[model samples]
Target: MDISKYIDYTLLSPTTTERNIIDLCHEAKKNKFYAVCVSSSYVALAKQLLEQTSIKVCSVIGFPLGSTATPSKVYEANQAISDGADEIDMVINLGFLKSKNYVSVLKDISDVKFAIGETPLKVIIEVSELNKNEIIKACEISLDAKVDYIKTSSGFSKGGATLTVVKIIKKTVKDSIKICASGGIDDIETVQKYIDIGVSRVCVSSDFNKKKQSI
Candidate 1:
């Protein structure tokens, strides 16, 4: 199904070096993947490397942990955009959501969305950290925040994306917001499962770094 087109071709580890990001951009461009997702700190470099290509550069905000203050996430996302990131994948404040501080959660996402100004905000709901109902609530809150996409995970947690959670998120977001199921996604077979279930994007992370090369 030409799954390469559906890949985000990511590298978001604490130890990701400059050379690694350069290599990642090269691979994404060569493979014709949809985008190259990297930490915001590397956004400028990835942008410079992929300036001549149509491949988008995605940057993460609030990263593996969503505990940071909303202003921090907003600034990070804004800076990433200024650095040439085409999309912002910001993690949701699970603490706020868990505490039923839905208002804070909504503002957290909305503020970032406002900061990015139409540069496609993908709210990482981190489905693995929430239950079925919480996942649904998070998706609904993301829709309210007017985010362009509701991503499943951060891939730095104990749990990762699952077909079950993807289905649940899809049912909630429907067509109002796009679904991006990330984490633990690698093989063509696994990726195809997400596509078949109507996921708009998948972060093909670890496997891509491993350079599986072929689906």
Candidate 2:
């Protein structure tokens, strides 16, 4: 497989600077990776830097932590889209889900999806914090909300993507939605494994950064 096409060169750290995001976009262009994932604050810069290039600019909303209200997430998504973000990676309210508030979680995703219009939306479910049943429920919610992708983690979580979870997601969604595995993936082998299990995308941060020579 052309592994780079399945990767999103991610840089979501709180300390990530503009220079860093610029470098990340440049690297994505150079490597012909799928896209550059960054914080919402950098969406404008990332868009300008990657303009006219095949590389896409992706921004996050209600990121890392999904405790924010649905309106806030929708507003953030709209702003990012207006700033030229080609796709949105959002976090689901884990607390709401754990509280069995499935309606709120679904509304959170659907509202953002509506606000973005044609732009793709990927919902992050922070797999480490969930059990197998919870993961299944998340997939169900993403499908109901009509999100473009159901992501495994935010990488800030205690763990990252696993093949088993990806497989489960694949089975649960049944091609109704795409799956993105993030968090701890750090190499071509792990990325390939996730792809084999049905992850349409893999979020690569530390591993890609360490290989800056190629960038």
- Per-candidate TM-score against the hidden true structure: 0.96, 0.96
**Tens digit of lDDT per residue, candidate 1, span 47-159?**
99998789999999999899899999988998899999999999988999999999999999999998888799999988878998899899888888889998888999888
Candidate 2 regions exceeding 4 Å error are 209-215
lDDT computed for candidate 2? 0.88
Question: Model 1, which residues run further than 4 Å from truth?
Answer: 209-215
Q: List the residue pairs that clash in candidate 2.
A: none
Cα lDDT tens digits for candidate 2, 1-215: 67888889999999999889888888888888899999989999999998888888889999879999989998988888889899999999999999999999898889889888889999999999999999999999999999999988888988988888888889999999999898887877777788887788889985655764553
